[model samples]
Target: MNRRIVLSGTGLVSAYGSGVAPYWDGLCSGRGALGPARRFADAPGYRGEPVGEVPEFDPRGEPRKSAYARAALAEAQRSARLPVLPPGALVILVGQAPAPEGGGQLDGEEWELFGPSAELRPDGAAVLHLSHACASAAFAVALARTALAAGAAPLVAVVGASVLNRYEYASMDVVRAVARTAARPFDVDRDGISLGEGGGAVILETADRARERGLRADLTVAGAACRVGGKLPAASDPGAVTDCLRTALAEAGADRLDHVHAHATGTAQGDTAELAAVTAIAAELDTPEVPVTSHKGAIGHLLHISAVPALAAAALSLRTRIVPPTPGLTTPEPADRVHHPRAETPYPGLRVAAVNSFGFGGNNATVVLRRD
Candidate 1:
């Protein structure tokens, strides 16, 4: 029998604070955490837009990214009431490997910190790092589903982290991709992406195991699909994203989705391309227009493991039956099939919600989540 993969717990570290409550509260309040960049030493030299740096992060000695990952994982483990594994669980670290300057092989150290199970550490537990730009977190969920279905492990722990430092901020400046004003998804006057730093984690388990432990699953990983763009790191191909979404929805047996968590960075080309793909799918299926949202407008773009926080928010939406507003999404264009919500809209009977994540290397990943 095929086991259903479900999300059991969540952890988050963002500009708002270190736990899931702060992150979700910030979203529901419709107040963005974006402001002047203070985490970097070379902030004054940055000619780009304001950034949403995590507050009080003083990376004096440790790698900034590792600190973010550790906090998120700790909270996730605690929330899930994770017990010591008996040499059968898997740990997937969803983040880019450390840069050469930072250090070498820190993934293992991070995993050790997150998963303290000696039995699993010796042989059962292994760390896999994905560097698929922004889609890394979404890919982690897809991998967890595959592992659970194959019975490779009874539980899969996915933790993701990403940060914006001086080096990366300068890189975005060179390409003129940094937003001059604010991160506005699907808005007519939107300019570019406002880079941000944050990360989150989620614990996945089989439905049978969750029931055995008397845990209520917030959302199930129904289906997922991934695709890559061709020869362009800065551009998104609508056709590829469309194909990926189509495959994921079809696999999930969802002809219509209630909500869509779009990976819209607020860039002109990026937002337009993604919405076009979603529009095509909606038209092909003849489904009602789906309410779409992008958290980047509120938290800025959390590069690399951006999808982790998005997945957490999607799960929360499923649990609470409310979809938070995509702050700064005022005056959405009328041409797109996906409608940008203006407030914290209550979605009754939200069975399925689709999430899209696109990476710089043309990686497009779609995850379909269902409640009930």
Candidate 2:
């Protein structure tokens, strides 16, 4: 049986600022936030490239990842405005673990931070940490949907965070994954992704549960599905992504999808593969071409936690019925089936939208959201 889950509220901290408002405004305004990595310029083996760093975030307090998680959680709880939840509610953190040598543990610290947000004892609460690479947040949402459907928890909070630091930057640079210039997704001359720091949180509950409390949802989690590529290491298979999207849309009972929030991060293979998958979906459905938008061009890739802000922007788009542009996309690749909006575009009165997130090791997740 399919259960209906609803999105109650959302919170975020991004390179644009510390709130969802700024993040959404930046997306709608089509302004890129990437700049020089001043702190890393003088460091050993510095690549002297641009990256997105969350302003005022200090890297010394490694465990302070909880700070970002907690701030977003508190704001989400406040925005939810629902009745007090049961003591056994669940909290899920979707993020990358600081290297063991970095002397940081994100799961425990995030739980400690999110625990206070609930009105009940922390001991009985269920806390789960998910590390599925870039698809982490999408997987987190899928888990939350399952928990709510099973009645295992009346409320669930999913938080994701990934901060850029010298260690990780150097690692990506060594592999030529870091762009030497700017972060430009889907551009002909795009080199690679610009690492960005920050995170986002979302509050969710079953639709029936929300109605029981006289609350209305901002968006509904129509459905979510994920798949793993059977290909070689650290690469995604377009076939896997296509299968994932088909299952996700079927799960959502959607025949007409209005927008696609792609996971394009300026990598040649990643962007091309994702666009191919999307184009296939369109051709199979025989629907009009889909307008796609990727936040990475403007916000930079947040690694394990990119889906957080992606979902936040998706929710805003669903409510507003507008698709934000791909900041640096000038030429449409793989034909016009995948529409890249260079400016804010209005939807054709459709309510369903899809958000795709792909991770290393061939992990791909697609979520279908509906507004109504």
Model 2 over residues 34-139: C-alpha lDDT tens digits?
A: 8876544664555666777677755344344556666677677777874343577898877665223223453643432222222221456677777787898899
| Top candidate (TM-score) | 1
- Cα lDDT over the full model 2: 0.76
TM-score for model 1?
0.89
Each prediction's total of clashing residue pairs, residues at least 3 apart in sequence or on different chains, is 1, 0
User: How do the residues 1-372 of candidate 1 rate in per-residue lDDT, one tens digit apiece?
Assistant: 448888877888888878888888888878888887664545544764667778876545555566677677778777777764336777777655533433335463343222112121325666666567778788888888998899988888777666776556666787888888878888888998888776677878888777776787647899999776654454378888888889999988887778888898888888888888888998887866777888898888887778877887888888888888887788886655677767778888787988899977788899999997
Candidate 2, residue 106: how far the Cα is off, in Å: 12
Assess the local accuracy of residue 294 in candidate 1 as a C-alpha lDDT between 0 and 100: 84
Misplaced by over 4 Å in model 1 are 41-45, 57-61, 83-86, 98-124, 231-235
